[model samples]
Target: MKARIFVTLKGGVLDPQGRAIHHALEGLGFGGVNDVRAGKLIELDLADGTSDEDIDAMCRKLLANTVIENYRIEKAA
Candidate 1:
């Protein structure tokens, strides 16, 4: 089984890297970007019997930092 996890900054967190990219985009003449957020993608290959509960635990333990970000998990073919 394949599990894909996406971790992103929470709404109130300040993302300096994202802001820099946003600024660069503006300099390049792109407009209408209100904000930017940075994130991480984690892919896991697990045994077929891995349960949803286990995956959620993995995210909570290592895949995401709950103090700064939120995570979403997807099961893939």
Candidate 2:
């Protein structure tokens, strides 16, 4: 099975990199961009029959920082 994990900062957290990207976009004449948030995508290839509970555990254990970030998992067809 193939899976994808999306990890992003929770609300109210400072994102310096996102700010830099927003500034760069404005400098390049892209207007109307109110804000920017950056995140990471992780793709996984697992053995067939991998359970959702196991995948969730993976996210909790190491794929995401539970303190600052949240993660969502998607299974690929």
Per-candidate TM-scores read 0.93, 0.97
Off by over 4 Å in 1: none
Among all windows of ten consecutive residues in candidate 1, which has the lowest summed lDDT?
34-43
lDDT of 1 by residue, 1-77 (tens): 89999999999999998999999999999999998888999999999999999999999998899999999998997
Per-residue lDDT of 19-66 in model 2, one digit per residue for the tens?
999999999999999999999999999999999999999999999999
Q: Best candidate per lDDT, number?
A: 2
RMSD per model, one decimal: 0.9, 0.5
Model 1 CA RMSD to the hidden true structure, in angstroms: 0.9
After superposing candidate 2, which stretches have Cα over 4 Å from the reference?
Answer: none
The alpha-carbon deviation from the true structure for residue 4 of candidate 1, after best TM-score superposition, in angstroms, is 0.8
Cα TM-score of candidate 2: 0.97
Backbone clashes counted, model 1? 0
